[model samples]
Target chain A: MSPSPPQLSPKELSAYFAFTEVSSLLRHSVEKQLKDAGQLSYVQFQLLARLGDAPGGSQRMTDLADGVVYSRSGLTYQVQLLEQRGLVTRAPSPEDERSTIATITDDGRGVLATVFPGHIATVKDLLFDSLTADDIEGLERVLTQVSAHLRANPPRSAGSRKKS
Target chain B: MSPSPPQLSPKELSAYFAFTEVSSLLRHSVEKQLKDAGQLSYVQFQLLARLGDAPGGSQRMTDLADGVVYSRSGLTYQVQLLEQRGLVTRAPSPEDERSTIATITDDGRGVLATVFPGHIATVKDLLFDSLTADDIEGLERVLTQVSAHLRANPPRSAGSRKKS
Candidate 1:
């Protein structure tokens, strides 16, 4: 006989999956929004915008990965692609030879300048415009709680637990 | 020039970019959890499992797509891949001739049965285990509120603002 499916109480279900749904929708909305101005993905736009603001338009790869929610390797791969496109360029970090630094090319900054206004507007509508003032404050507080807790208790065996 | 990148209020910055960090880590954790055994992506597992629970192991493609959070095109592509694997099949919908129905095969059920238990456990740990009871409740309420708000205030423009 097959094992019984573990049932989550409504509260538990709401607590766990509900927020993921919102976050996922937000990403989808963002992705769709980005597709309008140009071919750039949301992360690509973010990387360009960040680099445009950083000192000398450059930052270490590790910091960029953290800011963009990309895995280090995944970010490296994407950055290399952007570099090849002449959207950005990479150089050996002056601070650490072990690290690579990425900078937005003039072309990249120009693309971002073209794309960012509309992108930010979409973010406001899809996210901020939907929430009441109280809702925003409440959500910020809860998310902060979640962020702190997740940092303190990173998933351990959780990753491998779902494999057959 | 061009507003000097404007000083973003702290609240806006945190709300816009910060949660992406948590969502990224959570996705990494889920992906890592599901890589071995069958290498089933979360959407694939979700599609198979949802179909397994349907009458005749089938559901309309649009309904299934909404349930699993994929856009219609994305779900269609994924279902085609599953069909290639002989895990699912599609047919004309009887009640709605314009719609397509998706049906999971025995192999799909077998795969879901093998993977779902650990998936739920991992979800429970990756999420619930990291949150306090109050935090959980707070988050659920916040998400429910946000979800409803978004549905009510659908974006009229795809991407045109530059606030975030």
Candidate 2:
């Protein structure tokens, strides 16, 4: 076992607890909405939404995995599920025969359109409703800083390898 | 189809994106650490930690579910797993014979002690290292408000009934 680390400052512990608890609650709320409205899991919704927003309505599978922070094999299974549902289509990339590109199909767009209203409502009701504009700004600034730092120096345990 | 909702203000979108992304990355990082070092899933670790922190180091099973925002059946399963591992013990609540209480065992405390250093380091390295004192204070204040509001008006889709 590693030696005991120094105690976290009260501020650090309090801030972390609040951040984690809020994140968990928010995810639960969003996941329930997605499931109820679209029969979609949260990660599935994220993949569809990202593909819907991408240029030319498609992205390389590797890029999509990175964007969602999902492992390559895990993402492949998700994409396969979506393809079977006709919500997305995967094809070989034009520029690289070895790489695959995933595009949201018309069915995918329709599901997004159907689910968007409820999704937005849930987000607004559970998250934005309680946040003041100033609080939003502060959250954005702090989280952006923390995110960039973590992205650049990801934990070794995350196993986030970039596969081309 | 429902009518399109109004667009979120750019600030709202930006803030929510950062918040969600940060939350996701932090969870992945923490989960990896817990899995690697303690052979525990994130939710399992949460259950143990919360039980460890409760008064008398025990809490009603229903209360644990609410505190962790997990489904009743799901918490029951997790507690059963912990019990099999000798990390937690569940007994009928003395004050409420109809309810069960979960308590962390000495072995649970030992696992916590072993993994806590890595957990604290991961948190500090990924989250708090970049945050200023003011950022920490602001985050705690804003998230506390949001968490309370969401807890009071949780999403209908969560299906969080208090089962005795």
Candidate 3:
């Protein structure tokens, strides 16, 4: 037989389900808005937003993948699509020729500007509206701890196989 | 020019970013565990879990999709794969001939049993370990509220276009 199940209490189980389900719904809701408002898939929008927030509007390809918790190959394809749309540009990194760097284009910023209002509104409507400020604080505090723990042993895209 | 950005306070913005980033990382970590342990993708695991938890270990395909916040077509393909693997079977609903019902097979439960230990451990490691009882309650309370709000409107698969 399989190994015995982990000893999680009912409350722990409920919180886990709640976290995953709510996050999925929140993502789906914003994905529709992003698609309708600017034709951006969630990953594409994340790519653009990350680049837009970066210094000089740029980051290494692998870093982009890690930042978004996406697969390296998937990030490459999304960046290529963004490049084709003139929303971002890809080039060999100055610090490392073997590594590619992606930078947001004027059009990318323009698209983000176009979508930011609706994106924020949707998040607020679906999430913040249901949350008190204390809830938000508790959320940020707990998730920040969880996030730090997860990030400490970073994904392969970020920490290991960087040269791949 | 684009409309102005929403007036989200810095704290609100930080909380939002923290929420999205941490959720993504948590998902990535658990997906790896699911893949390695049972060769199940996150969606596949969720589908089986939902079916396993349902009465008679079955649910309509559309309801399954919405319960997991997956696209209808995507859920169909996943179900087909599961069917091929002999982990699940699909049949016409007795009450509604037009709707397909997916039932978890014994093998599906076996696979879930195999993956259950690792899945629970991964969630606990990445999430529950860092959270206190109060944190768990707060997380559940806030997320349950958000989940209800999102579910009230429901997704296309669950509410609107049900006849489609």
lDDT per model vs. reference:
0.74, 0.86, 0.83
**lDDT per residue (tens digit) for residues B10-93 in model 1:** 675576665666676677677765665457887887788789889899999989976776667889888998999889999998
Q: CA shift at B30, candidate 1, in angstroms?
A: 1.6
Best by DockQ: 2
Candidate 2 per-residue C-alpha lDDT over B1-164 given as tens digits, one digit per residue, 9 for 90 to 100: 45657566777778788888889888888888899889899989999899889988899998998888777899999999999999999899888899998999999999987788999988888887888888888888888888788778866645735745
Among all candidates shown, the one with the greatest TM-score: 2
Per-residue C-alpha lDDT of model 1 across residues A8-80, encoded as one tens digit per residue: 5688787666667777777777777667775788778778878999999999998998677566888988888
Clashes of 1: 5
Worst 10 residues of 2 chain A by lDDT: A155-164
Enumerate residue pairs that collide in model 2. none
**Ranking of models by TM-score:** 2, 3, 1
List the candidate 3 regions with Cα displacement exceeding 4 Å. Answer: A1-4, A155-164, B1-5, B155-164
Report, to 2 decimal places, the DockQ of model 1.
Answer: 0.35
In model 3 chain B, which range of ten residues has the least summed lDDT? B155-164
Candidate 2's DockQ: 0.68
For residue A120, give model 2's deviation from the true position in Å: 1.6
